[model samples]
Target: MALPTLDDPFYYLANFHTVLDWLGSRYADLLSAEERDFIAAFEALPRASRALLVRMVMRKGVDFRASRLRYAEIGDTRAAAAPLIAAGWVETDAELELAALFTLATKGELAADLAPWLAELGLSRSAGKAAWCAALAAESPAPRALPAWLPSLDDTHYRLTVDALGERFRLMFFGNLRQQWSEFVLADLGIYRFESVSLAASSRAFSRRDELEAYHHLHRCRERFDADEPLADLLAEIPREPFDNPWLERRRGRLLYKFAYRSERQGELRQALALYHDSAAPEARLRRIRVLERLARFDEAWALARCAENAPVSAAETQALGRIVPRLRRKLGLPRGAAAAPAEPERIMLTLPRSGWVEGAVAAHLSRDQAPVIYVENTLINALFGLLCWEAIFAPLPGAFFHPFHSGPADLFDEDFHARRQALFAACLAALERGDYADIVRRRFRDKHGIQSPFVAWGALDERTLALALTCIPARHLRLWFERLLGDIRANRAGMPDLIQFWPDEARYRMIEVKGPGDRLQDNQKRWLAFCAEHAMPVSVCYVSWDEGGDERERQDAQGDEGQPQGAVIEDAGAPPNSAAGGNPA
Candidate 1:
């Protein structure tokens, strides 16, 4: 039975258990050993303060989190949260919702599980979905919690821990990336390439898409991406210029440092000393001191460094090292001067734009009668309008209407194809007539189920329009796009045209391309056009010109010259000064 949920302010205070333990440990030095004392003799904390610490602890602890589907299926909802609401613990935030959902997954019903009942007897009024979705939207991705069942959390377990956090949350959640990232999984998880999605509900930014993009980016490392690892520029998101693939270059220096540092962390002095012997760089040597001082091995770390040919270093640099350095010096030998150091590698994040011109709510036209700038600008415009009109009206409505690339003869009757097509055509015209893309989508489509916003409008369209539109998009613009998507620059690549020269002063690199052509596509071009049609990142196309470029012989000559290069694919540069993609380089 679903109980009426009263808003619970105390619910606003739930947190991970680790946070509380950390805070409690800070006062361990002040507290006297109580092996001989009775618990009754100790003073108790106030309820308010006790609650605060409890909440903090819950937020920080990584143990007890489950990765099973049972946990994910037991999603938090207004009804499921009713128990917390009843207990005055139902404030609306991610911690509270996740906590409540977690309780239901393990303990029992914190609130009525809402999905079944809502599906059976539809919910016309649900502040619950809204509130819970809001909560999920704000959650930063937390460190992966290990199952209590793991023997010991090693690096493999550490990797799985991150995986489990992904499995646990039903709806999207924010990831708090403040903790250091694991190096082993870095390339596979696209940790460096930035991304963001515009949340429909709150104007508030959520880091979920950022994490998802990073994850997808990393997964590309197998097979085709092997050894073609992203450069540090791809990891341009890292502090200091990351050394391309540090694993491939300075792996030993960093790995040894990690081993020595971890040894110090575990208080294994002999092991740490052995690991430091593996270091080759000055940076790695200094890192040994930092770890030792942190572990109160100051005398050894200091002595070890001095007995070598290491060059003299700055006092400021020494003082700026680890906090444990001075503390270790005091404990292991005579203490030296101390200087407060701000947190290094501060919490810096790379946030990609949520929405822009390519994905923006705007309209521009292309031509279909004749392609290549050799044709007049007016010709390009009328042709594009004709191409789309023919595409929208002539193409098979649903099955035949599918984007030619992503799907084949398989799975023809899926409802998504028709629904999306109707929505795309409707949304495009709505924006075209209104001049306000966002307003049109929000007014006509957002609540309607499929098309919602422009972010999804392009891909959500049926296969036919998508495939044809991609084919219609000129080749040159597509080339530049393929380049930007890569983590590394292509070797033996020709210098790309700087179409940055043609874009409007206001639009950096955002306008959608208009591929115009009055003719049918040849075989080689079709292969590429198919890829774009299938992926649908953010683009639309229309045939611009049909009859202005060089002959088939010239095209073949261009492709086959001795120094011309093989496996070459022609693509658009970008929007051009005269026509859309500035008509071929002729």
Candidate 2:
């Protein structure tokens, strides 16, 4: 007994059930009602004829040769594929034709088989490749008119409408379209494995493997792009292959951001803004703001700056904006300071033994049962201030800040950064009266954008803390003093008073900066103290010294030169006997 070849009617008769079952289950949606009815006619065929039809359908082509099927897996004699020939699903060929072989070569079939059997056909490797490509170029399967009963898909929604099986199969079949078949292989769980892997020799599989490796090499090259690289070729190639990964799009955006930044730095402000338009990062917005201002589009810059005023920002961003806003205000002819708001004329400064002693003494002196005190200077103010003005500080303003600094100027002087900073400060000041302070503070703590102060921790910001902090400093005065300190956030961020003592009943709080004898005020600290005094925000400086030699120390104003003291000293404690007279504290 022997099995019939693909050309035999017996082959179709034998395999018909397999093909019909496949179509009914996996590709049932693709068949029209009439086509399905036509296919049903095959059920009436004798079992033998149906089996042959199934095999031919599984092979998925119309041409075959008995000589090619000389061997049989089931111990069947090779006979002509008569049932498929009669059914019109396949046609018999005298032998393998050059066009067919070339097709096989293009599909990675001949490459592996060629070396072992090419001598039988008398062809060279180079010549074989050319012939494969030529056949691929010329070979187009004849299109059959679609059945009338088939459901029509809107061309616009074709991609979206593809069923999962259909889509995966399409990728399997046509994923390597326009490229050599050996260049692409569907290895992902055989969704594209309609053809038998055994058809192409093992060596040809290796060749296809190499081609896929080459394709991924192109992918790696794409990841190396920076602002300085030549990107035209890469940009063009990025969309050529339909890769399914999402990170590729992100890489493209980053490249575009770098390019836009470069263009902006080159003084091509218009081009830079255009390139930056696609980037949604806050930094991109900042860059656009800077460009708009540089181009004298002040209104546009101001509008964007206002948007950034409420957006979450970092400490560095807040400081940058602080520096930028005043300049922008000056450019817009706004006054730098409010109309001479009178502050407290009397000033008090205390000297402590060391840094750790300042907060304890201040807390002891000011802490009432109703009003609790916490030690939070740079980190707390920065966190709270940054939370309120986060939008301005973290707006991703172009060239303001970078990690692992890149070459080129940061272009931080543009008016929009500063202008937005001003808007943010104003917004923070207004938020105090509207009873929305807690929510913003909550969001800031939740987001953890720039929060670093332990005292401003989410749990630490209990009801009492938030209520006091919100009302502690006068809104107008806080705005004025905060504005003055914005000149340099990094330097000024740390110099805020060591303790915040609030009187909840009185709805008042004081910012107290402590200095030890021989210690002096820094430039930023002096600026903050001056602003606080000028705006009537209750602020104090305490100078502390150790009680060595049983000494009694007096408080002094710490505002003169960097290392020198200014203002009169008031004695608070009883003087020690035999104390040296006229000795400078330093």
Candidate 3:
């Protein structure tokens, strides 16, 4: 049935399909023929009529009356559109007689559709938005969109505020404000750079007993600063002699160095170090240690650490640094030493507990008939040497150990990389059998060496190597092998179809994870867990830690029902992830 078309752009109102098409097409860069016809007729509609059509279409999607009770929200459609709705939109709603009297003032025949649609329009923001949009379309050049009114008070305000307040204020206000603000705008505004400048200025002003302003005004360098230039004479008229005086008293030089080190200025740290040698005040000494720590100069930090007897530190300082001792030991390449006990037997090696990928690495060696452990002896020696160096390098600073190295430099500690490393390595191997790569920093990863000795033979018959020999087997034996693990996936896959890879080289598959000394699990171990769980196979986790007294080998296992769990591997049906128990029976 053809309802007479109105002049309003919704002139195509008679065709509901055309109205929906128009709604969808509004988002499109290209409009269909139906939409073109509708727009053409719509352009001829009166302002009020066009507004009504826009509101009607948008309102049909929501509940209006309850919306008024649910959200008496201000600046919204429910309140503004109520006046038109009370004018008898529901036909039977003669309930609002007072509203009827108000609409009676209108000159035209009160349209039945107007009140009902108006109620719908009141139900949603879309309805109100549509009305505003239609009005915008009609009054184009008369008034632009609301975009021209809001103020652009963003970073520029902070910059101006900082300049007026001075250093201390800028540090407190801008640093706090920048940290609290979101990462994007704050970082993009160069807040951190401003912060460093503010802190430097604040340190100077505070030391001079200057009153802090509400904001900080700091000099900003347009380019990177060069420490080689005479800073005091070049930038400010301040005399460097008194300010930087070494044994002459005022702590300005030391304080400035502390500020520079905290701000990560390398040039500043070097300057601070030079003055430290000349005066070595308690504060200067601490700054020297702090700067060295920040630069990851453990040995230097340790050296300064010994002179800290006169240094007063809070109780909290000791507690905080206590956690860093282990990390320090590792960073200095200290040997973690041997595990207390023989680790449990496993086809897999202990990794640094990672989450996603497989654990342990098993590279294959192919020969005529035997792939029997060719890579074992080389791997052992590599570990022994790394451990030896770690033990020698990580130690507390000594009082008289500033003695010269027999190899060359008197102060080998102050020597550069090329000079120190060779000396350091030579010092570590003074007790062990030394030859060729013996005094070298690098541990050999491959054992293709022909000349064998006690050191090479010691790693050859290691207990961990013996365990790998027993537990690991050919990839073809994985199904039977996984039955020993505790996880569920392998057990469930016993009677079901499963995809499997038969690795012939290591004589073991990727799933036959191993555990050995000093190896930690990385993030990839979850796959092993899930793989065993999917196939209902058992999973075995081997641990290699001291077992109090005797140092025992330990293993834990988890298992479940067989033939693929009820809903095993629900994701991609492309042969069900990986099952531990065995190969695809299909």
Best model per TM-score? 2
Which lDDT tens digits does candidate 2 get at residues 463-543?
555557766655555456456446544345566677776755555666667666676877456656655666555666655
The TM-score, computed over Cα atoms with residue i paired to residue i, of candidate 3 is 0.19
**For each candidate, what is the lDDT?**
0.31, 0.47, 0.32
> Order of candidates by lDDT, top first?
2, 3, 1
Specify the poorest-scoring 10-residue window by lDDT in model 1.
Answer: 344-353
Choose the strongest candidate by lDDT.
2
lDDT of 2: 0.47
* Worst-scoring 10-residue span by lDDT in model 2: 153-162
Tens digit of per-residue lDDT, candidate 3, span 246-284:
222233343344334433454666655555544323345
* Candidate 1 CA-lDDT value: 0.31
TM-score of 2: 0.32
Q: Which residue runs does candidate 3 get wrong by more than 4 Å?
A: 1-209, 213-255, 258-270, 274-284, 287-307, 310-349, 352-586
Of the two candidates 2 and 3, the one with more favorable lDDT, higher being better, is 2
TM-score of each: 0.18, 0.32, 0.19
Alpha-carbon shift of residue 30 in model 3 (angstroms)? 62
Can you write out model 1's per-residue Cα lDDT over 112-204, one digit (the tens) per residue? Answer: 443443344444334455454344435542432322212232211111122223221211121122222221123123332111221222211
